[model samples]
Target: MSEALEQVAKNKDDVAANEAALEDLFCVISSYNPDFERDLITRAYAYSKSHHKGTLRKSGEDFISHPLGTARICADLMLDSVTIAAALLHDVVEDTPSTIPEVKKLFGDEVAELVDGLTKLQKVSLKSEEEEQAENLRKMIVAMARDIRVILIKLADRTHNMRTICHLDKHKQIQKAKETLEIYAPLAHRLGIYSIKWELEDLAFAALHPRKYSELQQMVSQRRTDRESYVAMAALQLEKELNNVGIQVKIEGRAKHFYSIYTKMVRKGKEFNEIYDLTAMRVLVDTVKDCYGALGIIHSIWKPMPGRFKDYIAMPKFNMYRSLHTTVIGPQGKPLEIQIRTQKMHQTAEFGIAAHWLYKEKGSSAKSKEQAADKLAWLRQMMEWQSETDDPKEFMKTLRIDLFEEEVFVFTPKGEVISLASGSTPIDFAYAVHTDVGHHCVGAKVNNRIVPLHHTLHSGDFIEVLTSKSSHGPSRDWLNFVQTSRARNKIRQWFKKERRQDSEHIGREQLQEALRRKGLASQKIVASPEFSELTRSMGFLKTEDLYVSLGTGKTSAQQVVTRITRDMDSVPDLA
Candidate 1:
């Protein structure tokens, strides 16, 4: 065949392949939403394919493949039709000549808005790369705050990128891998999407440390036979016991992911062989009662290791994760980890908010959706700090702390479970309960015993915060021990408000001193038109803002004086 004819044939083949891919995706979507609009998906796929006609990815695949893969992921999560359509068109406005208004005209407002949010989130640059990354993170969080589906699409897009990341150069691979490990994985974990979180972590780990990844892979593979044999033996024994107890159960074993195993090694300073519970068995039952009954039966069969039990069903994690996790001695005296949960809880444990979103869409009430969304108070807290925090570094620091910290679940006097960062103090708990509760807190009672405000709380602790209206608000000392960003930020805000006047006074004095040194009358310059323009140019709305910035050490007095002199020099002097 002629060259042109051959090229045309290849294009037809690609089109057929793309259609097959979309057919598979449609099957997945129909399983969840039988009435989902096939026409919308078909239009989106064709629009994306045409827009990306000549574009190819680094992996030498059609650029259309990326969006198609992303949309499939969203479909697997049972996301709404609009999100799937947005996923199909997410890169169109950014990478192609298409614009948001064009997308809105083509699709509807919901898809256009999501595409716009993803577009804005993709563009971030500032003074340095670190600042740019921090800014990008802030943008993603803000976008999520507005519409949670934005991050959902972004995460789907990232998962596809990581899956095909090997096409990039070494430096690019490491950079993308680190970003995924640091930002995206944690976001997935925070959302309680373990399926995505685990995949992201393992993929990133492989990219960032290829040698260590190979080492761990070899180690796990080498032990597969023995592990499988042991798991089968344990499963059989457990099945017999549960059946005897009249509990219907399905037990399955899973190898711990490489990233999690590596984390355990580094955290415990142990070698691969030194670590136990390399495999975990999950028991899925029909009811919450069966979950407890299975846990009891498992414990009766094997002696549980000390302090290795976590009853998350009684108190779910901040991300709405619930399971009864325990490590016990098993056959051949090896440590065996097990989790017991109802089949419904198992779904939530794996799919997290996506499962809730699916529930909300299946004719569930609006109130049910709100209840699921209320669990994401962390997202709202990020928005609060983003508004208050001007420094990108500070915002990223708080974000890292919030994401990476292990959780500790404590209870209030009213039997409400409040989740705080591990090593959290009573002040953190107080703020978690209410800002007023934290400000008025004078002392605390952990399990009915008086304890210092700085005492580090443990799980299952019943805390009672003692407050008095006559007492002063939070102490500067609380800043030293508070763990949660909410507690720390609230304390700083209190101080900032209380000391604003003093800061203004000090800042004015510093400026006047600098003016005296420059042989300029302080009052004349302060009231000058030049000064008004300078303050506005310096990003202050009013003179008090300038003073506050100076007092807070955010603006140096010398910096202000230098700007003033420079502005004066630029202007023509009037006689």
Candidate 2:
């Protein structure tokens, strides 16, 4: 037993020394940013180590090791000293007796705020274990709205947790796996952090569907040799083809991960043998011109599959992802997927948000900050959706709808590209353009042809929304077709303001008829001071609000009458 314990400790030390020593983290960050504050990092490490000493995780490893590992990941992103400090101190407030105030005192205000935002997530109260998996999702989103660093820290924390999930019990493992799939993985994808996003997915899939995961893993393993050989042969041919065109390029082959293959299998309802593009050939070039040149060459080499091409370089994703993709016939008669991008784009593809920190050229840091702010503008949009309803569950429902969608890129009349969630309609497009445009929109033309408001937009379609000053406002029917929460919220807001008077008029008529049926006078009820109280009891601040609810089918006049009768019955003979 003693010998085994010594061996385990020795192995742990060896692994850490080789790959993730404290000095390695320092050296990596210094290489990226020559002006970084190494002294501050060392102090943060000592402070976090002191606070977390003597604690042990479920794996029986020292708890301080978790913070150290998280900080190491932050260093890998080439983050600043403050973010790395926050990563080390993130769990102290939630786990230890220390408070946010102490973190502020010890680490300053910025790091303290991040730690506070993280600790707030530990207090989520959900409906049930099964139904409320995304209960804390809204809270994290709201926190992200305040500071994008909050989520970056939290995502790093979650990555470490998921990496060590094997230490947890089976029941807890399933719970965490579901949470990661439903929330963190999608969040990472939205942030364009594919480095952690793909790993989180595979880890969760392994835990949640152990048998299926093992089966797919074995399948991938069995095909490793054949796929490598095929990819090698294809790379050589592609390199020669590009070289003849004088477009200097580097070719690499990437095997698809198990989770992606499984997703393709289920999404397309195909077996492994039927799945095409098991391995993607990525071509890196020097310039944007060379990217398109390579694409044309790849197509000329192999017969291009119809509708299997996407030009993301021309129209980058909202998260700033860019690549040119095409599927074509290759050796072994297999459909090969090829991606072409510049070297800068390839870095962005791999590191995503971290790419901004990886280079320290002049003006790059400022540009990166501006880009980070732009990317997190979606957090403000999520907050806009949250403003409509207080129910975290409902917010999460809409959030999931937005999160799981594949992107669709459409164009404006002027040729500017507008990216939206897949399945978005003309109304969603109009709203995405502007709230005022959506409100006054009377009709739309897609590709110079008139289409209904509910017309689902396909990629590459140019959309023109026809507006009229005489148009009253958005119709309630638009809700039935609008897909994005941004569009849905804007439409609901228009009705909530514009239709309140209409709702009140309709509600008053409905109330009068109900009063007559109950043999009570409507005039008397409105004249009484108790009317506002009656509306308040029904969860409305004013009678007009009650009427608006009635008009929207959210409440009925009959229910109001029943409440009135109960109130009257409670009164004594003074009535």
Best by lDDT: 1
Model 1, TM vs. native: 0.88
TM-score to true structure, per model = 0.88, 0.83
lDDT of 2 at 442: 96
- Candidate 2 clashing pairs, residues 3+ apart or interchain: none
Candidate 2 global CA lDDT score: 0.80
Model 1, position 198, has a per-residue lDDT of 94
For 1-575, candidate 2 gives per-residue lDDT tens digits of 69999968865774465345668778887887877767766777777767776677897667777887787777776677777777888888878788888778877777788788888877555567533445566677778666666777777888889899999999999988988998888888887778878888999999999899999999889988888888899999989998998999999888687788999999999998888688688899999999999888888878898989988888887667899999998887788898999988977776666665564433454565566767665667887787675555666778888777787889999999888889999999999999999999999999999999999999999999999999989998998888998998888777666668887788888887888777777777865777778888878888788887887778888888888878753322213
Q: What lDDT would each prediction earn against the true structure?
A: 0.88, 0.80
Q: Provide the clash count, candidate 1.
A: 0
Question: Which segments of model 1 are wrong by more than 4 Å?
Answer: 1-13, 359-371, 468-473, 507-540, 546-575
User: Which digits, one per residue and each the tens of the lDDT, describe model 1 over residues 1-575?
Assistant: 99999888987887788888999999999898888867877888889998998998997778998999999988877887878998999999889998999889988887899899999998565888878988898898888777777888899999999999999999999999999999999998988889899999999999999999999999999999888889999999999999998999998987799999999999999999998779788899999899899989988989999999999998888778889999999888889999999988888888777776672342443454466568788888888877777677777888899987889888989988888899999999999998999999999999999999999999889999999999778899898899998988888888878799889999999999987877777887888888888999999999999999999899999999888888864432222
